[model samples]
Target: MKLEKSIIGMVHVQALPGTPNNKHSIEEICEIAVQEAKTYEEAGLDAIMIENMHDVPYLKGAVGPEITASMAVVARAIREVVNLPLGIQILAGANKEALAVAKAANFQFIRAEGFVFGHVADEGYIDSCAGELLRYRKVIGAEDVKIFTDIKKKHSSHALTADVDIDETAKAAEFFLSDGLIVTGASTGKAVYLHELKSLKDKVQIPVLIGSGITAENLEEYWNYASGFIVGSHFKENGFWKNPISKDRLKVFMEKVKQLKK
Candidate 1:
């Protein structure tokens, strides 16, 4: 959970069973995830997070038991290989399910959605679940698994909280005891507004992480603002999320990060 200036690589696990995009077996998906994890570790990422992003047309709320089971199997397999901190995120506001997977897989954290405030996401309305999510974590004894929540999250409409600005959102999340705050652009792979990052610096005590659109070309611009960067698409082939991880691309980005750390 110590994410100061850390680079967390995303392992976008392929479509799982019962979803419309399920073409590969769980075993096939796990193999791809493990290989990507090895590449991320080899490329010197500080952490790895497995997400069921490819489970497209994502379920509106919590996914079925099959999705959870598949994720656990994939997460456990990845854990067996990589020594870096691991995490999981069940899509479309499945924070509770994510915590369960993290605890079972021995992951260090989870990227949670709708921690504070409501939003109209592509999947549907995701209600604020800070109280319920934290209670579940306590019930399951997964407090050690950090929950990094999204503020003004991508791929969603925040019309429900239009009066609530980014800084206010950050404060609310901090007040609700989010382990960290994730700031992102309007959509996936889009860069966050530099001014938004600047504005959030003095607003909250919790870690503020850049959750999208951080590339090696512009890493220096965001370097001093965020405690960590969660990267996915930029490390993939041709900078597309659906593409497989590109070792060379990841290495180049990490090399720059290493230089900055020095």
Candidate 2:
């Protein structure tokens, strides 16, 4: 699937079984996830992505099979409900596990971190996963599942690779075969700089997505440059990713997107 110029809604699934903040049973998690996916499709999102974001203080690199198992259930449930393209992200850089889940669930793609340069994320050190992850995808027969990687990913210190600028990072990821690139501010809910975004657009051949802080109010600033927007916080009740997806907010946001398309 060629994913370009898509308004992809972030469907952050409730904490799945085995995480510290997990409150719902596996069934409950799947139910809530399916409903969120349904709402995003009904509101006109081009695609919806499921994330284990609520699994706070995430694991450093690998996740247990239970995490993968529950995600499979949720992903399948969401697939059953929504006809739009669906994707997955296993937090804290579990790119291989996420690919396995995406394949089992028949998901279209996955959002990944630590695909190129090393970073010290809040969870701990995340090593580059590109070589292993891509090989794993081939072994699993999931070459069609695209991997959209984060460059200088949010909420982390890049001092380790400070010498390597964003442009260098973009070339490296491309050399490593990333299907797309993501640009973000320092953290979630923070806006990506248009100048920096333009710089990246000038630097890379792959699709560039704004990974955070996109709202109806600021959509125009990025629409001309970004091929996609991975929106989460802006669709919630109070612009919080933790809050449930607000249909009214989504409707209003999509209305603005429609006008921009004109």
Q: What is the C-alpha RMSD of each candidate to the true structure, in Å?
A: 0.7, 0.9
Q: What is the TM-score of each candidate against the true structure?
A: 0.99, 0.98
Query: Per-residue lDDT tens digits of candidate 1, residues 1-262?
Result: 6877999999999999999889998889999999999998888889999999989899876999999999999999999999999988999889888999999999999999999999999988989999999999999999899999999999999888999999999999999999999999988899999999999999999999999999999999999999999999999999999998888888899889988999
lDDT of each: 0.93, 0.91
Name the best candidate (by lDDT). 1
Clashing pairs in 2: none
Q: Estimate candidate 2's alpha-carbon lDDT, on a 0 to 1 scale.
A: 0.91
| Candidate 2 local Cα displacement, residue 69, angstroms | 0.5
Distance from true location, Cα of 49 in model 1, Å? 0.5
Candidate 1, residue 206: how far the Cα is off, in Å: 0.6
